[model samples]
Target: MRFLLIEDNRELALATRDRLTLDGHVVDHAADLATAQDYARTMSYDLVLLDIMLPDGDGRDFLAYLRDIRSDTPVIAVTARSEVSDKVGILDLGADDYISKPFDFAELEARCRAVLRRRAGTSSNTQRIGDVAFNRLGGTLTIENRIIELRNRELRLFELLADNPNVIFSKPKLVDRLFSFDEDVSENAIEVYVGRLRKHLAASNVSISTIRGLGYRLDIG
Candidate 1:
């Protein structure tokens, strides 16, 4: 999944972006209102992590713009205000979820997944690839009741492939989907993660196959 995080707090934004990437999401970060608005208005994203307070304008104002454009993309508001009315007001303005400042990254990830699953109309929390079970809600992968020891990036790659079995994903698309906007990634980097994941799932019925012109796909028997 891909996300746009519009946050002014530099340290917080960096940390949040890093965590989202580690969880297998591509994140684009904008420090202020202008950049955030431009990206939200012009680009397609699975979700937006928007901070209500901004240097150039209020995040709610941007929300109004988003609604005007008729974009159904989910927005999760991040703000310092914890007032119930404040959260309700944002939700009424089309925000999908609200989290106050100083939140745990795990909570943010859960919100993102919840919103995505709702939008996709999927009620299940677990996805199976052959014998490997991916717990999307809990962020764990297990094979035959035993957890697979996969590093962060590799686990993310496997999740992506397993989530969309038999769909060929190009290298560039995989790179964009797997890495943060600020991260330096290449096609070779994608290959590295794919190789690691292939090894991790070697004993399972899941296999990663390379397409002649396309890219890679998850083949489960």
Candidate 2:
């Protein structure tokens, strides 16, 4: 999944970005609210990790702005404030969940998954496409109860395709979701990943179909 991390603390932002990247997620970090607002306005993110205190302004204002713009993207507030009133206020301001500072990265990731699951309207993190079973939280793919070994990028690509079956994803859109802003990506990067994924799904009842001039889609029989 693609994530926008709105944080001012360089150390904490780096740590959070690294943690999420290990799970095959693409993360873009903004050091201040201005850059964050620019990112929010331009790109589409699966989730946003927002810090309450910012260098430019309060994160609550940004949350309100997002809601005012009618953006439905799920946001989880990451702040140092642990008071019940603070938590309630953040949620009331449009945060889907709240996590205090000095929190565990595992718990943060779990909360991210939970919020995403809720947004997707599914209680379970596992999604099935034909005989392929994908555990979104665990980042595992299984077919016939056997695990299929996939590299991080491969798994990320498959996750996007599986999550939106039959939906055509353009190459640019795939690149945006699969790679971060700082990554040096090649023009044929998406094609390479798609080719690799197709080979892995060859034995299953699922296929990745090229839409020629359009893009690609996951087709299930």
Candidate 3:
């Protein structure tokens, strides 16, 4: 998964980033609201771990702006404020979840995964497509009883494609879904990844089909 960590506390931000990176997630850090807004505008992230108390602006306002841009990107408020009203306000304003400050990094990671799963229309940690099965928590893919190892990005790519088999996704859309601000990638990069995934799926009779000008789609039927 890819994430943007918006926290003014330098120490917490570094620790959070390190933990997330070690867990196979690509993370981008922003020390203030200005940097966070700029990164949000220019790049895509799977989830945003936002600190409500920022130097320049309120994180709630940032959440509002993100919604204004018609971005349904999931956000989790990581703040010290634990009041019921505060949590209610952010959640009502479209924040997917909340994590109190001085919290466990493991819990944050778990929340991030949960939020993404909800957004992706997945009911739980495990997802299956035809004969292919994926365990989100385990980060393992299996086809017809055979285990298939995939990298973080590859796993995410498969999830996106398999979620709605036969639905085409454009290159830009795939890039947005699979990459974070830290990954310097292009549309062509998606093609390369798709090529590799196609080869891996060749033996299983799973196909990632290109729909000409439309995009790529996973054809299970």
TM-scores for all predictions: 0.78, 0.94, 0.84
Candidate numbers sorted by TM-score from highest down: 2, 3, 1
Which is the leading candidate under TM-score?
A: 2
| TM-score between model 2 and native | 0.94
Cα lDDT of model 1 by residue, 71-175, tens digit: 888999999998999999999999998888889888887788888777755767776656888777566678777876566667667766765666899998888
Residue 156 lDDT in model 2?
83
Query: What TM value does model 3 have?
Result: 0.84
lDDT of 3: 0.83
Kindly report which residue pairs in candidate 1 clash with one another: none
| Candidate-wise lDDT, in order | 0.82, 0.89, 0.83
Q: Which stretches of candidate 1 lie over 4 Å from their true place?
A: 18-26, 41-44, 64-72, 102-106, 116-125, 136-140
Arrange candidates by lDDT, highest first: which order?
A: 2, 3, 1
lDDT of 2 by residue, 14-60 (tens): 99999999988999999888999999988999999999899889999
**Which parts of model 3 are misplaced by more than 4 Å?**
163-192, 211-215
Q: Enumerate residue pairs that collide in model 2.
A: none
